[model samples]
Target: MNQESRRALIRKLVASRGECSVEQLAVELGVSGMTVRRDLQALCEDGRLIRTHGGATLGERATFEFAFLDRVNKNQEAKTAIARAAVRLASDARSVMLDGSTTTLAVARQLRGRSGLTVITTSLPAAAQLQHEPGIDVLLPGGYIRSASPDLTGSLAETNLELLRAEIAFLGADAVDDRGNVFTNPPDNSAVLLKMAASAQRVYVVADHTKLGKPALRRFGQLTQWAGLITDEACDPDFVDQLQQLGIGVIVAPFE
Candidate 1:
């Protein structure tokens, strides 16, 4: 295919799926990763799409949630570091609430064999990882499952959350603007997060640096809702200072 045709196809794919990674687009289009990235760069420059760490999304796709697998692959190293740092918060807590975000899933995988810990989660992925641990007790709330994600949400999940409380809740967001405003897609997802926050004595937002300074469709909550924000070292020092000014602690996970 010609360059024009490839670029056009790229636009179509991103539009239809809301997001597409450079490598995936190359495989689908029978092109090299370099070629696909070039096309994506051009499209982003033209305001046709928004460039993410390893992919591009529809220019106005803030309301669209990327596929779970896609997210799990992006910023892998950073997410791993953030997860390691966030898991330390659970050491002294008797109970913990983990949301279904991929970042939180990383933390869940590390919580195995912790004695006397009650794990409450809406994420099937996280629950699956901890349910069989000898020392950890996993709790799965009842709710409607979102086909796109393993998370259970809706009134049933919200009601289930009200009956339970946790020492700390680790949540995730699609974006966090410079003003410390947190955003996520779909009202249902936000509803569950809000309920989780209410049910926990402390809340921690876990996200990589890529999520900072971006704004998504819905403003689910603010930075103040959380006890602190845990992110990778790739985050800007200035941004960290701003968060500190707001009295929101910032934990920068070490990575090498």
Candidate 2:
């Protein structure tokens, strides 16, 4: 398996088992002890695990991170479908911006094989997903790391993003109302997302069916401000019609 997939498996194993020896991971993954040790060290640095004498255990931060991982897996089918459609929208862009949402992380997974692309993201998980891709150059803007999720936020990150530009940006929303207003959970994320949208030539909000016709704590921007909204087939047709009536471009992703 690739490093990303292997490390993800290691995290799941360590979380499930509470702890795992280097030898055990090596055997489980069919890799060398050295490889397992390297993976463990990386996980420790990421605050996902605590290294012991011969094994590793879940760290204090693991609970929150694992919860976020669970969120990522919640709408697997719809997120995957949305990601595939978003990828097609980004096919011609050489430089792309991605937000820290799990849906955008799905887009990052779909972009791993593309060559000569520059990916600017505030999501640590998305950067890690594409870090080993020789064809893609991943850039993370410097800022305060969020405790709620593996993302960078605050003024520094916004300033850094302002200095960069991308051909297209794929952002995720916590909720999107029928009026085509996009919302985010934390109010602070709205500013950073605005900067991301301003830095890109075109921006597309990628959300699943569950997020439609809902409003979150903070309103970021209207869908009219973006290039379009990409959602899954499960989205409500009436809601789609309402958005279309508002002159919003909506792309419904077909499940394969």
- The candidate maximizing TM-score is 2
TM-score of 2: 0.80
Worst 10 residues of 2 by lDDT: 183-192
Determine which window of 10 residues in candidate 1 has minimal summed lDDT. Answer: 60-69
Cα lDDT tens digits, model 1, 117-196, are 99999999899899789889999878998867778998999999999999999998888887788888764388889999
Global lDDT scores for all candidate models: 0.86, 0.93
Q: Which pairs clash in the backbone of model 2?
A: none
The C-alpha stretches of model 2 lying farther than 4 A from their native spots are 1-59
TM-score of each: 0.73, 0.80
User: Where does model 1 exceed 4 Å of error?
Assistant: 1-66
lDDT of 2 at 5: 97
Give the per-residue lDDT digits (tens) of candidate 2, residues 130-241.
9999999999988999988999999999999999999999999999999999998874488899999999999999999999998999998999978989999999999999
